[model samples]
Target: GEFGKVEEVKESLDLAYMIKETQNLFKGIVEGSSRSMQIVKDLRTFSRIDEIDGVIQFMCNPCGKLSE
Candidate 1:
């Protein structure tokens, strides 16, 4: 039947569209996760630098007081 053939074609096209959309969604998720990981990495690096700076300041304070 011609009508049956038309319906089958429509179903196939819909399935293809869904597959494409799903792939795009997954790609976006991966990109977003990568960005989030990078942000966390940067935050950790900044925190470490802040800790080092604090230690340096603490070590210098006693010397400053002795000089005063």
Candidate 2:
């Protein structure tokens, strides 16, 4: 059955293409998510640098001026 064989090949190729496309999409999403997470972390760290330093100094000071 030449037609049957041709149909089977076409189906196989289509299935493989779909799988490849899905895998690529997932990979892109994961990469983008990880990059976004890294950017958020960096921003948070940068924002907190001064606050963290001030907090540490407050902790070192027994006067507890942070109540103000």
Candidate 3:
């Protein structure tokens, strides 16, 4: 009976560790995807700079910073 109880405890601990690891992996994937999305958005804004009526636009905000 004592040995069975020890085995159960070990299994529970293993499951907890695996869950934590999975969470960390998903977090990284989400962060990477967000960065990629931002890059694409910035590229779109940059492309629009050349779309004016023969006038080059800075494509920036009032603070002189690139619009996010």
Candidate 4:
């Protein structure tokens, strides 16, 4: 009975959700800026360059299995 009372106590959780939400809000602010938009565009271009990265990795897996 006494131990069960401890289990019912409110537990404080870490601030990870607050940090994530604030980061998302800040990201929106940054992305909305003109300079950030240019950087975002550049990022998109760079990201697209790796659009085939997964394909290349997938190909390597089969090749490695075959070479075994």
> In terms of TM-score, which candidate is strongest?
1
Per-prediction tally of clashes: 0, 0, 0, 0
> How far in Å is the alpha carbon of 68 misplaced in model 1?
31
Badly placed stretches (over 4 Å) of model 4 are 1-14, 35-68
Worst lDDT run of 10 residues, candidate 1, spans 59-68
What's every prediction's RMSD, in angstroms? 8.2, 6.8, 7.2, 12.2
lDDT of 3 by residue, 6-64 (tens): 99998978988888999999999999999999999998886776565423444334456
lDDT to native, each model: 0.85, 0.84, 0.79, 0.70
- Number of the top-ranking candidate, with lDDT as the measure: 1
* Model 3 per-residue lDDT at 62: 41
Which portions of model 1 miss their true places by more than 4 Å? 1-13, 55-68
Backbone clashes in candidate 4 total: 0
lDDT of the structure predicted as candidate 4: 0.70
lDDT of 4 by residue, 40-68 (tens): 99988866666756654545575556444
- Give Cα distance to truth, residue 61, candidate 2, Å: 29
Q: Candidate 1: what lDDT? A: 0.85
Candidate 4 matches the true fold with a TM-score of: 0.31
Candidate 2 at residue 18, lDDT?
89
Model 2 TM-score (2 dp): 0.55
Q: Lowest-lDDT window of 10 residues in candidate 3? A: 53-62
Ranking by TM-score: 1, 2, 3, 4
